[model samples]
Target: MSSEHERGDKKGQFCSIPAKPKCGDCPHPKDYIEVCKPTGWFDHTFKRFVNAKDPFTFEKKFEAHHLVCVAPVTQILLSNDGINSVIEQTKWCINNKDNMIAMPLWGHTVKWYCEVEESISVDEVADVINDAMKAPKFKNIPQHDYDHNCKEGYTWEVEVEVEKLADKVKEQGHKLKGKALEGKLNKLSSDFRSRLLDDRGTRKGGTHAAWKLAQKEPPDPDWCQPFSMASDSKVSSKGFPVRVFNGQVAKWVNRIAKAISSGV
Candidate 1:
């Protein structure tokens, strides 16, 4: 039979031997020798001997073979560098086609045997195997660093400065205490003014009392009053009421008013 058919048969069959014959002492052996097995021998030998090993170990071997088989199919999908290396190796294989088998298992098994036999070093074979295995995952190469920054690209900077300005609102004492006092003063002023308006309307005439009383009633479920001033006033003896007329404070108040008007 042809060598390929003979190898195929050997891998598919099993036969019993009298005993483990010594290579140097066999009577029928000559200077040159060829060992051959019938069809299904390797499969049967594997089932009887190799399968007895731990299942996890056998699974890893199966996975390795699977990776090797899938490698060539994905070679073109890899990067330029990876594709070039595979193309070069394939060209070499083409030139040596007469001496080699192109089947995935044959290629992978030959590579393994070559490395074990020292016909090729482990490192050299490993480089080729690694490139092949990585061919499928080549598209997912990382482009960013761990710090969320780009590599070999633009850099960024932040600048900050501290400066003093005139007429700034400076709370010389405790800021929380100052804000409490200011809130109390605003509440007191609002309550006093509202009371004055009510008394003034009562003194004006009875005609204005109805309108004033209606305004003083709580607002409707859907409609609301524009302002609801608080009724409390407490401030430090040294504190005086001051109103901002310009700059940042005015801008801040304008922003707050706009936000409130937007109902957001």
Candidate 2:
């Protein structure tokens, strides 16, 4: 998960220059150096994991090596600075590319992967872009700090909620194991995942209650980019702030839940 950065912090700053240089728009020398691609596109992603002992069976769609937890598919930003500074400012981001993704009972192993499904530009996915040409030169705006370390104990809160349900089942003299336990746990966890991953609540015209007018808009861009972080001090001579998106660090919260319930 990502952490929130307090405003005005130097660590939350990002270069103000747009990804692409506009002819008359940018006041800098027309030949200014561009380290990042203005309209870069990704064509593939990679994923790797070890087999799990007691995987999940409820969501067949999410099954992997008998484990319920799996890495989410996302794009990576490869920078020279050893993976920090780039997206750490954003909230809800993973802090490290390679780390143990812990659940309530156990930690699952995962490898970094990158796959870009659509051809989108940097301007398309960036949260905000400076195109007005009125912003200051050599400016560093504060980015939302998303370097929260949620890899471990991410499901603690959710596990507590499920524990209550398990106790109720126990009070009824029912065995909270096998399919019966799996069914109940599945509904709760599935719903929780949906709420966490859903974006409809944040849309402009939610539910399409009323029609809105707008000019011919380009294809809706894929803005879901996952970021990882590095230390604060200058780590590389290259001076790049952002690093490539390592594989997603997904938590298998369900398998652990079952383990805890059955005392495994």
- Listed in order, each prediction's TM-score against the native is 0.12, 0.25
Candidate 2 ranges with C-alpha deviation above 4 Å: 1-43, 46-153, 175-179, 199-264
Question: Candidate 2, residues 1-264: lDDT per residue as tens digits?
Answer: 111121111122211112224223323332222321122111111122224596543211111110111121011111213222332222211111111111110111111110111233434422222221122110111111111223322233343444465455546555444355435545554554332223211233321110010100321221111111111221112112112222111122233223323432
- Give candidates' CA RMSD values in order: 42.7, 25.5
Per residue, candidate 1 scores C-alpha lDDT tens digits across 161-181 of 000100011222223223343
What lDDT score goes with residue 108 in model 1? 25
Error of 2 at 135 (Å): 25
- Record all residue pairs in model 1 with backbone atoms less than 3 Å apart, i.e. clashing: 12-39, 12-40, 12-41, 13-39, 13-40, 13-41, 14-40, 14-41
Model 1, runs deviating above 4 Å? 1-176, 204-264
